[model samples]
Target: MEAEACKKCGYTEFKKGKLGNGYVNLMPINSFFSSGSPMIVTFCGHCGEVSSVSVEKPRKF
Candidate 1:
C-alpha cells in the first residue's frame, strides 16, 4: 500500500502494522500460523493529520 497525503497538513507518510487473522483452536484446524493482512496507515507524524487509504491486493504468481 502507498502512503497517502494528509489533507490538513499535506504530509505524506505511513505507519505499518497487521490488521487481523487471529488463531482459533478448533477441530482439525491449525490456523495458528496464518499471517494477517497488513495495513498501511498514513498520517502526518509531525502535524498528526490522517487519511484513510485503500490498496490493491497483492498478486501471486
Candidate 2:
C-alpha cells in the first residue's frame, strides 16, 4: 500500500493491524450463524490514531 498521512495527526507512517479474534469477527446484522470476515485496521504509528477499519471480505457481510 502507498503511504498516506494520518487524518487525525498528519503522520506519514502507518501500521497495519487486525481488530478481531477467532470469535470476534464482524458479523451481519440478524445473522448470528453466519461466519464473518476479519476486520483490517490501519493506524498512524507516530500518534496511535486509527486511519481506517475495513473487512477482508466485504461481500460476506
Candidate 3:
C-alpha cells in the first residue's frame, strides 16, 4: 500500500505507535472475557497529527 500523506501538514514521514496497558485494551463488542488487542496508532512525524488508529489483531475483533 502507498504511504498516505498527513491531512493536516501533507507530511510523508510517519510513525507507528502502540497503545496498551495491563489493565486496558481494545476488546470486541460484547466480549467481556476475551483477551483484547492492542491498538496501532499512525501519526505524522512533522505535525504530530494522528492519521489513523487500528487494532493490531483485527481478526481477533
**What's the number of clashes in each of the models?**
0, 0, 0
Stretches of model 1 off by over 4 angstroms after superposition: 1-5, 10-36, 55-61
**How would you encode candidate 2's per-residue C-alpha lDDT over 1-61 as one tens digit per residue?**
8668888888898899987786888999999777888899988999989888899888987
- Each model's lDDT comes to 0.46, 0.87, 0.87
Candidate 2: deviation at residue 39, Å? 0.9
CA shift at 54, candidate 2, in angstroms? Answer: 0.5
lDDT of 3 by residue, 1-61 (tens): 9878999989999999989764577888998777888898999999989999998878876
Kindly report which residue pairs in candidate 2 clash with one another: none
Better of 1 and 3 by TM-score: 3
Distance from true location, Cα of 52 in model 3, Å: 1.3
- lDDT tens digits, residues 1-61, model 1? 8766777876776554333333321112344443433444455666765555433223210
TM-score of 2: 0.80
Better of 1 and 2 by TM-score: 2
In model 1, residue pairs whose N, Cα or C atoms come closer than 3 Å (at least 3 residues apart or on different chains), thus clashing, are none
Report the lDDT of model 3 for residue 42: 91
